[model samples]
Target chain A: MKSTLIIVALLLMLGGCKSTGGPTLYQQLDGKAGIERLIDSFINQIARDEKIIHYFEDANITHFRDGFINHLCALTDGPCEYIGDDMVAIHTGMNINETDFNHVVELLINAMNELNINHTVQNKVLAKMAPLRAEIIEI
Target chain B: MSMLKFFLGFIACLLPFSNFAGQGKLLATPGVSQVEGSAGGGLVPWAQLAGYATDDEFAINGFCSRADVSDYTLDVCGAQINLFNRVEFSYAEQHFDVPALNTKIEQSITGAKIRLYGDIVYSQWPQLSLGVQHKSLRDGAVATLVGAEKTSGTDIYLAASKLHLGALAGYNWFWNMTTRYSEANQLGLLGYGGANSRQKLLFEGSTAIFLSRDIAVGIEYRQKSNNLGLGEEDWRDVFVAWMPNKYVSVTAAWLDLGSIAGADDQTGWYLSVTGYW
Candidate 1:
């Protein structure tokens, strides 16, 4: 009976490790708290990218942070609606470059990692925000 | 014919990269390699005078200019552009003089920047690119290599960039190092290939700091090895750029370039303009 119980436990662990792809991503990151936690971590990292922190000198520190969260929440099919400045208007004079943009993207991915979000879930989120490049960078 | 075909094949590989990597924002600069930054929706460098990459991968940009050197003599300028992203293709030429000196020279540079990794428009951060530049002067004696003659010099660099804030704000940053050799021992005749093709490595960087609806400021720094096969030199600059709307952009800057070759350091102001449609 002991061996039988051990075998059952092993099988359950194996099942848990299986790749359920999309369903697993949804299960891991679908909730509101999960989304909020992810956004919180992302902003914290951006604040720390010392090389670029100076650009935000004029940004409404707290407001920008919450605005980004709301912007993201609405993007991932969440209930929040983004009520921030239009992309072009907000970034009018900022001379953004690829390195800055990619670095921020990396911080975001790291944020997801801290939240224990899976790769598939992360990719899904990136895909939704990828098109925003047009609005974010000044060409 | 074989060489031509080989060259064509080489060019085909570098196309679409311009589609995703072009700075659509920045313009050509005399300083460090430009970082990967976005120009909102276009594929152009922010500070460069011409676009390295267009919406398509394959593209060519050319320009000619004439500057008054102080008297009856006029200087003619020419630069070539060819690109596709992964691999780079470029040509630059210059021939100007102080007619009173009865002397003139010319130079040219050919180089490439490769695409390594990262998202083209991920938004959260800038685009990333790593590549090498092999620039050199053409076949000309020191006294005759006037204006914009080709240079026989090479440099390597790493670049990362992005676009931000839409029309309200944006910035592009990059770092690079260049090596210059003295020709026949003349310091002013250094940029183009000089004396047995000396090799000097430099550290350079530039940033286009934007603020407001259509105004921007830029800062640049370039450090170089001053060896006719010898040592090093240093230089730095500050600039202000204007983009009244989205179609036209202009930049004027002040420079501090201790010296080059045997020529006295030509530190002064520079102006550049661009119209995008």
Candidate 2:
């Protein structure tokens, strides 16, 4: 009986580990069109957020949008490769603090919520984006 | 009187409505309230501070937890405050009811935590914190009869926690490790020390994978010192926490507390609810 219980517990743990067996995140996010929509929503929300909007005052909206979409696509294992400059190079002079970085993340979260993105998918994206804090936060 | 003091402090913290409000960055990163009134899992304290305090903000959190084991029932209620996202102060009232013996033991615990270094999500190094809990038994007579060494004791602990984003196929993973020096049996409800009165070092660890931005499932194991010789054993649990939003969160767990007061296999259901501002 004890061995059986141990086996059952192991099975439960294994079941939880199967999250990686599904489709790639790019496909799960509905490919290019979905990526485009997500980026559009995110950019719109960032524009409305006064906390971080000043950072984008001199940014070219159309160029930034395309570069961001391509960056996200490449990060999620999509077919497209990002052509823009690396994150560190682009954000080096921004003088972003932890508070500013967090504010942008909050806007991204709001955008994801508005797009009705699954919470798990949202976290997946955020997880990939989290490491960029070190590169982006200059101050 | 201690209980009254705890309640008064809780009420005072709640009265500062403007100071206790606002949200922080990240989801499911600042752990919820643990059973002992610290920010952590149900049984073990994690390194993260409680509430939604950002760099320049203060926040408050309140929680209640109940666990129904085979031989006893335990209830805990507490409130915690985060100061400038650096320090935390908490107070909790605990009651342990053993229906078979028709007896109850009450305890009041005051806890403080200081974030020494690192950020949970932003830093490469694990966030480290130092914590201390001062516990005093209200039912001193009953506790002494159970071979308890002292009615009051202090527990000191150091905890480290880290968040590894995209560690598991894009999912976020959280890990925590804590080292505690104490002689408390059953988390000071049955009092501190006893036959083996020497303080011992104990380890507690927790790891969780984010199923979503607002949901996490994890397991925790806490090693205990059997100082009282009442067959105290290690504690283990598998828990799932759901944070619907910043203001509210709930957790449910299947806990196995090994043994307590000679009652073996004390397994049960644990549930906790938390409200933050």
Candidate 3:
């Protein structure tokens, strides 16, 4: 029983440690320039990925680049507001399945690896973006 | 040997599907295969299916495991098919060497699992699954000598699993709980039931912390029933698994099975490898 209590206390401590007032995610990501570099790397990754490349064939690359960088900046609490199209509106009619969406996520992870992003920061970024799956897929 | 030929044939059969092989789930999301041929830790079945298939894809996996303890050694080989990440079918052949008895026992298990609801990572609730395993003993002399009632039995289980991203000190945490109803004695190697002959509810659990995206260290506990009036015991293990990619994984564990049949302190080392396609 004493061991069980210790385990429970440890779990409670771990559970309570979510996102306290340390460095903001934006600062940890090195601010706007870092996000832009990430987006450029992500775009390059998507370009090389054949499985999901066709989805961008008719896309406006410059517009997408700017919108995505702004989106990331806003998502990460950087000093930016995304005045772009909604995620649902942008992904509608593309019929992107879960496989393709996950493929894109993998490509982004590859990009992050190439940039030598810390694993913890990458997980935070993915967590911030994961909820958008509902808005972006199977619509 | 014939087993090698059969394994080669199995690979040949999978060749046709290689062009459309599905790896839809994130790497290492689908847990490694268990001893009973289910997607789980080395000892306990988790709620996840066996391969990297999502709702729109299918996957196949093959695995082999061996546990060598003080008085016994268990070798198992199996294959699993995951359809749409919703259902799984598996088959496993087990060979048990009982050095004390100067004999060997063999059993085959056929298993099926269905995902009832939720996703391990994306859902608010834990992923739930229902599963069944039908075990048949190929050699029943030891079972009969132990006063077993039957050489075959079925186990039904309900399992729930969840993966918490960055939940444990910036690493991923995964946990699973399974409740099973069975009358199998020593996983049916000693056959099913006995004079006691009552089915009992059992509990199994596993928890793991992913040090990296590709590696996990975990512990598992499984409660067992002494249906045959033998001093069967609960099982526990500490395991480390490495999934370098979605296509392959390796696991090693130190097991403390307490006792089996009549032998006490049945501790061992276990190693397993799984290949996904």
Candidate 4:
């Protein structure tokens, strides 16, 4: 009976010590404004990366930036709705290969690193983006 | 010596003298090469492919490994290719030396692995693969003297692997489990089966914690069958691997091979160097 009580007490203590108020990804990325800046920097990196620049030659920079920011904000649980086209619809017939996709991911990681984003947050963001490879690569 | 010259030439060929341009795939995902020529931890095989190849690409890798124990020494050299991130074909040659017995054992292994389902990364489910290895021993007379049933055998295995990114305080965690059916003794160095001539099912498991993008530390446990009643026990190891770049990786481990051929508590150090493209 005493051991059971001790276990119950320990559980309560553990629960009490648990961190429930840690900053969310949205706040860690500094909300919509910071997301906008990240997208801007990411676009610049993509524009300069020769391996991926050709894919964006015909893209509309302003529209792509807006859509990307909104998508990123929504993905990070910010107060925004992604109004862009679905991944499959947007990438169909683009002939984007795995090499291109990985290059873009690398550029994004570089952008995040330049912005001093924490590694954990960077991985979380990348994990969210990784699933889109099915719809975007050679689809 | 010729062996040392070969080793040096291998390293020179794998050296990152010039960057190969336009390579895709994530870093360190394919993992370092195992002694058996598969992509995995130091001693055990994982379900991952052998190189930095994605679904639409192919890659090739080569490695050499050496293990020094209290009673014996082992050297392995092998190569493998990953096709479209799905299938892997490998070949390895192993040399075992027992100084006390003034004898040497040599074996050649051909292996193949096919990915069945899931992804190592970017998926909730673990990646699973099926593998087969055919081993042939060079010294048939020595094998028979050791009470082996055959000088050649096959091992079939199913392995599952998963990586949990940022699961532990911003660090990645890797897990793998393999089930194997085999009749080989001492991984086919002493040859197939034994006096009992029975194939047995065994289990192997590995878990790792990633310290960074390029470094990981892990532990492995492998169960073995004692068909000959030679007091062969299970194997275990603690290992650390470093992939400084996509082209090169190195692993070091402390391994326990239990008792082998009357040698008890056979503990050792294992080192391997790998190159991938």
Ranking, DockQ, top scorer first: 3, 2, 4, 1
Model 2 Cα shift for residue A61 (angstroms): 1.8
Using TM-score as the measure, the top candidate is 3
Docking class of 3: medium
TM-score, chain A, candidate 4: 0.82
Misplaced by over 4 Å in model 2 are: A1-34, A73-100, A113-121, B1-20, B197-199
- Tens digit of per-residue lDDT, candidate 3, span A5-111: 35545764785787778877788888988888999999999999888889999999999999999999898888889898899999999989988988899998999
DockQ for every model, please. 0.05, 0.31, 0.50, 0.30
TM-score of each: 0.46, 0.85, 0.93, 0.87
Task: Report how far residue A119 has shifted in candidate 3, in Å.
Answer: 1.1
Clashing pairs in 2: none
Of the two candidates 1 and 3, the one with more favorable DockQ, higher being better, is 3
Tens-digit per-residue lDDT, A1-139, candidate 2: 2432464466445436745557777887889998999999999898788878889988999999999999899888889888987888888788986656787888888888898987767767877677777878863
Instruction: Spell out the clash pairs found in candidate 3.
Output: none
The C-alpha stretches of model 4 lying farther than 4 A from their native spots are: A1-20, B1-22, B196-199
Residue-pair clashes per candidate, as listed?
121, 0, 0, 0
On residues B130-211, what C-alpha lDDT tens digit does candidate 2 reach at each position?
Answer: 9998999887887688898899999999999988765554567777889999889889888888996654899888877787
Of models 3 and 4, which has the larger TM-score? 3
